[model samples]
Target: SRHAQFAKPHSLWLNDPDSEQDTDEDDSDEVEQIDQDEIFDLIRSISDPEHRSMTLEQLAVVSAPQITFNSKVPDRVTVEFTPTVPHCGMSTFIGLSIRVRLLRSLPERYKIDIRVKPGSHESEHALNKQLNDKERVAAALENPALLEVLEQCLSTAGRST
Candidate 1:
């Protein structure tokens, strides 16, 4: 049941050549911690708005190291993405894609934090604010043109609703 709930398998077991078999129930199984690779896979296939031929991964915008889940606080997930160019105009949309992907894939308890990687974009703070703004995100998603673009980007990732 735990395997079914997780994207990757959660348990592992190894036998020692000279040691007695461990029979402790505590050693029976351990769940793997959710990590950045899992987060990366969720958004790696999102297509860049400017370069429809390239996914964000190909453009080096989204990376695993930039994604972090707070160990002390299981409800938080922060993803920082870089644009192919510092002046790339689609940074906001890229952030939106990451946000949407996580929203669809992660549990409701997760508080997603989507931002532009520091020093990677010209207007990083403003763009981060826009991307993280609940009101702005809601308004942007309501616009048919914007939603269309998001759908186009996500469709390639096999996650568009």
Candidate 2:
């Protein structure tokens, strides 16, 4: 129910004995190929920040077509989401919830690229930069307050619509 413990667990990934074997099995022997539908299934049910009862899918903020897998690269997945309005303020939380869900579900080798659907938000560029940058993402995860809220949003990952 609460898989948020692994949100930014770099050290745990490295040090956990159980995870090391899991990682080896997941990382080397074979590559896990994911499709748009599978990726969508992973994130589509995330709880919307503004509406507790609505999933991102229910709100039409995200869809399977908005996700793309890089067949050429194989390890990169890009996900785009349209906010409720051009200037919707819950963009970061929604983006973070998507990223966190993927990070928790996907193998370590996959590089997730998350962004606001182009032109869907007034500050699309800035929001995209903050969401994609490793530094900013790590910084955000460090805040206890934000993490609590993010955990709440992500807590409904698969249990909802």
The lDDT of each candidate is 0.68, 0.71
**Candidate 2 C-alpha lDDT tens digits along 1-161:** 12224334542111111111111111112336677887787788787766767899999999999988787986798999998888676676678778877877787888999988888989899888878888867876776656666666666776635
In candidate 2, position 81 carries an lDDT of 96
Report lDDT (Cα) of residue 71, candidate 1: 81
Q: What's each prediction's TM-score?
A: 0.75, 0.78
Best by lDDT: 2
User: Candidate 1's error at 12, in angstroms?
Assistant: 47
lDDT of 1 by residue, 30-133 (tens): 22455777768778878876676788888888888999878899669889988777877667777887887677766667789998888988888888888888
Model 2, position 76, has a per-residue lDDT of 93
Q: Give the lDDT of residue 151 in candidate 2.
A: 67
Backbone clash total, candidate 2: 0
